[model samples]
Target: MRLNQYIAHHTKYSRREADKLIESGRVNIEKTKATLQSVLQEGASVFIDGKRIVPKEQFTCIVYHKQKGELVSKSDERGRRVIYDSLESRFKHFVYVGRLDFASEGLLILTDSTPVAKALMESHLERTYLIKIDGEVTKEMINAMEEGLVSEDARVGGHSKSEIVAMEFAAFAYYEILKNDKKYSKLKVSITEGKNRELRRFFGVFGREVLDLRRIAYGFVNLNALPCGKKRYFTKEEYKSLHTFLKEHSTKESKKIESRH
Candidate 1:
């Protein structure tokens, strides 16, 4: 395997991220510096940033149920509570699959194989969330979200010249009315894409403010009632289910989209 591939396969960084390490001269092949196109010498030593790393096991993949207010990061300059802080010390080397914002809570995948993480982040995967927001969630609001919304808001990654809704449409996969208090209501939504802060912005178009957001599932993996601020390795059955979801996602998305509400 190429040096970049070797690093990505062995560590948490992706192939693209591995290339950056090589470019910065932090990677070596048998004490000799390695470049992007360099391949392994059958069996040789490899060091990253002067730390020799022998190929370990298959790789570690963990699912964490994050709590609100815990940042999904290693360390924040703001010194706020972070997800890894509450996790086992061993997870210091792993990177999270995606992120749940500071105010968001629920499922997150952490792993040492970027390839696996990248596959899960692909557009075909589904992410489910339960959101509590101000005011009643009316049919019109749901329909607008399902049909998609329009805005020239570049802040949401929309092209200023294009219909904002055309950039990406987040559909509600499933939802339930948990509350209808005149001041607040709760509902769940599932979307395919992981655009930056997309959900909060999408709902903002209809004058809804998401007060609390908790992700419950991602494709085949679910929080499964796991306690908050805890992490664990996936089970054999869970791994198989996630792998199956990745394999079938392309075909599944089409059907899922057509049948979505």
Candidate 2:
């Protein structure tokens, strides 16, 4: 891994922050100034600001039931409450696996290992959600959910300030209509991709507003009976499953690298 990645995986600083530290002449490898492109050597000592870094052999992972109004960030400049405010200080340095928008709530995974977080985020794991929409479930929506949709302008249901315009929505992995009525409609949906405001944008295309959205599960992790704004450690089975997943992911990544070479 690069110097910044090595620092981020072993320390509380993010990759960007690690880059800044290296540029400022703070990071060192065996007393030699570390550069941005420096690759970590196995069994080599690393230091930042004169303090030696000892990488942990084991990493911890946790799941949090994020509330509807909380932002998945360290700090918001606008004074809005963030997930860290509700989460314990001990987890302040953990990296989140994926994001849930301010209006959306549900199971969120955080881990001390940046590698684990990045691997899970990049994988095509299914995320299941229970969503309620403001209008009836139309045939157009059903067809789109079944066959996928491409939008030239996909800014409708996204953040008002988001610059992303064009988006292609993959066909939902699975969907089941739970309730359909004139007042509102509810559905259970599963998708493999975690695109930006994807569910909202998909519904927005059909002129339907998502009134409520909550993720119930991600891969092997599930919210179960966890209350809002609370957190819990991974179960024994969950840990086992995570270990298997990480192993397979590492193998696949290595294969990709070898193919490239």
lDDT of 2 by residue, 117-220 (tens): 99899998999999999879989989999999999888889999999998999999999999999899999999999999999999998888999999999999
Best by lDDT: 2
Model 1: per-residue Cα lDDT at residue 61: 79
Off by over 4 Å in 2: 1-55
| Candidate 1, superposed: residue stretches over 4 Å from native | 1-57, 154-167, 175-181, 245-261
Candidate 1 — which pairs collide? none
The digit string of per-residue lDDT tens for model 1 on 136-201 reads: 878777686667656554243222343445335556555567787769998777777777667777
Could you estimate the TM-score for every candidate?
Answer: 0.70, 0.83
In order, the Cα lDDT scores of the candidates are: 0.75, 0.91
TM-score, predicted candidate 2 vs. hidden true structure: 0.83
Query: For all the candidates, what are their Cα RMSDs to the real structure?
Result: 7.7, 3.6
The candidate 2 region of ten consecutive residues with least summed lDDT is 1-10
Candidate 2: Cα lDDT at 174: 97
Show the colliding residue pairs in model 2: none
